[model samples]
Target: MFVTNVERREERKGPPAGGRALDLLGKMERNEREYDETIAYALALASAWSYADPQALHDVMNSLGFENRCYAVTLSNDAVSARTSASLLQHVDGSAAILCFRGTEPASTGARLADTGVEPARLHAWKAVQGGVHSGREPMARYIACRLKRAMNGQSIVDEKGELVSVDAPACSDATGEPLEHRLKALYITGHGLGGALAALAAAMIFEDKEHEGIRDVVRGVYTYGQPRIGNEIFARRCQDTYGRLLFRHIHANDLVPMFPPPSIGTFEQFGHELRSSAAGWVFSEQPARRADTAPFGSTVDVLAWVKQRLPLVRRLQRPFSSDEHAPHRYVSVSQRSLRLRRSELGLSLGRLRG
Candidate 1:
């Protein structure tokens, strides 16, 4: 059944009249199944580009309960380059940090290139990573890692132009005079769409590269929405074995992006736990939905056929395009509804046990 405009509005607004706004940071648990709503909602908001302004990103994050949080740091290859864009925000209490990557933007040539370059490339002699990975995301991942290393070391973060960028507050010392790394409790990585793919790759780099080992223990988790398959079987297995439990991939129903570069092509695979959002609630699955065979290297005939197959469903939804389902707002809507439903169920279960 198609969702009506009213339902979509309700999903975006949250809580019928005045129960309470969904708590953005309350009841946060390290475990996968519990206390995920906050992470899901926060990360979904974190994915948006929102003018690519550090101040704007900081304002959005502040609204999500990051009290007195340090200013956000925006990263790109250069001042005028659109090759990469990501934001880093550290909590005021120094308990956590969030690195959010910008999803693909239609106006961005760099984003378009990153989205299309999904072919696997081997990286055997790299400092830490050693296997086949997405060609487009690898370099960006390394760049992020390098910058993060500098930030953790208390050095000023700089863009490619070598302009000074803020990593945390100017003082670089907490209330207790401890270093940023010493006070940091956890690091959370997130993104949407293509950004999600980059988030996964970044996490892999942190896990495999010894240079980042210092902050590895503080990596709380990776939360992503509508991310596509990023690496080959060997790379997938390595990450899955190492920090699979820390990766939470959320896919809303029929989001076409996650289904791309199908497993049939080049041994590409998605690893880690997947939470599929639907009207019923969030469905947990270890296996991804298998898509129809898509010929390698963007075969025009096969690609057209695939698009044609989903056209009917897309039309029924009244979407502007078939890819509309992959929009960040769509994921946000689904996550809000699923979280409310799950919370309601948990309340009822608790009530029954009490009775």
Candidate 2:
């Protein structure tokens, strides 16, 4: 059975050429403290970007004093009904460029009603790529890479009066008319939940696209919160090889998305130092977590277990309740100002990232 649009690829696989995905963790950048300046800054930006409105998003960024007037934003244009948000924002002072992605909207509850088979969801799972077991393309990653650039030029269906956005769209004259990828500099990418998953894929996309070497390695860094697994082990290995110490994946306790979509079967794996959330804040480490049945298949027992997991009673039994942990607000409750309204407080309402 298909867990969602992204399913376990029972056929093709990514070649097992790359090293263990966990090995890449050793090479990831370390955050000495969870609430340090860097993380605080990143989480704040992530919260701001989650919003569909630029003036509002920028206001959050502006309050934090990050100058980014020109931005390129895009939401998913796929038929899967996956609502995605990817944007490139340049710092007003040009210190570092920020690409912020939005996670599943809080209003998207798993049990929420939808038309026919269309359940309210945020991510679009991809089929197996040309590679082997550990090698497969992440669909959302590919979508973001293709659309984010033109999106900067207001090439989006949302077309929510791009002119009304505080950030200006991309212009050919800006990067000396060079390809958008070549002009990216001091780039920092961050996302939450599926947004985090896409940001992870988005980061790897640039690094793998050596043709766009300008953006291939020029990224200042990458940070994600409660992100789901996007690709196979080979993909994780590739992310490690490409981003290396530049990547950091942060997970909160009981955040199911990060535990998701199965690895052995789905072939998806997470790479980078695992920053586990703690009562004090976040704790970083280079470790492989227990394999979760993100997309349980094969036996009827497994399917039954998956069904049992969704019951409200089961959720009540868990700590950090998936709902609270998945939201961007919980990730940045340390910063009170950033924890307000729909931008930061959305997750507290209701949401889901599918199974």
Candidate 3:
């Protein structure tokens, strides 16, 4: 069934209408018996994409809710296929699987993060620490909980009773008095834009803490996509000083979200480390759509221009950081076949079986 322009207009009225549609969509998607039905419904909704209201799109997403909706399918013969719901499309598949949601809003992004039990306050603190402050002694856990509770007020993501209806975090580990590895992995720290900086801070804390030696090496690589605001130079430097190398930062050329420059106080080069920047190709105009198999490395001129337009301070900051010159490495363009091969090497399959 085709969604008419009138239906699209009706959906755009307010959150309530959007919520209703989304709830219906999510319910359908979650039922395995109704997978085809839901897919049909989603396709119908997607058709309305041309004239649909952005708010309505968000509401529909809220309705679907988050459920490990996407996965890397492993076949009986050990072949892997990357499968995602109709709504979302794959962006980049390589050493890490990077997927983006289509037509998402700040509210939905926040809800997604909250659902993972990562509240705004914790993120703020994470951002603060990533800017080079030590938050170990701070009452971070309590503060985060309190701030999050306050933020949930008057929001649809929460119920009338002020209880969250969608988000749930895994229980913190009792044995180690820390968050579980899988829990941390599941936490979409990068959803709300500041996730990269927060993750950087979290990584710094782990490296600095002598007691966390068990997981020190585990925090080595940081993969961030569409990280809106730039992180603090001091924080990046702290990571470099401790880890002896800066984290790998990947960006999609068209992703305007992460292109925004860091504040003057937290310039990218201030941390005295070299950022290994790589560029990938994005499929859609907006973020979180299906990506191509191979990503191209931005040319030197292109990369410099990107920094100047998006991160002006980086150009100035790059000079001093060159003092501790590491051997320059050539940027490798990623190919689709390479990505598939890489996944195979990791004991996963990346192709779908034809019916």
Model 2 Cα lDDT, one tens digit per residue, 170-217: 322212222222223345678776667666766766765654455554
- Ordered list by TM-score, greatest first: 1, 2, 3
CA lDDT of every candidate: 0.59, 0.47, 0.28
Name the runs in model 1 displaced over 4 angstroms: 1-23, 29-35, 49-52, 68-82, 106-114, 125-182, 262-265, 295-322, 353-355
- For residues 186-235, write the lDDT of model 1, one tens digit per residue: 57788887778777888887887787788788777898887877776777
Better of 2 and 3 by TM-score: 2
Worst 10 residues of 2 by lDDT: 111-120
TM-score of 1: 0.72
lDDT of 3 at 254: 36
Candidates 1 and 2 compared by lDDT, better number: 1
Please state the error at residue 102 of candidate 2 in Å: 1.6
In Å, residue 240's CA in model 1 sits off its true spot by: 0.8
Q: Which parts of model 3 have CA positions greater than 4 angstroms off? A: 1-192, 228-231, 244-246, 261-338, 341-355
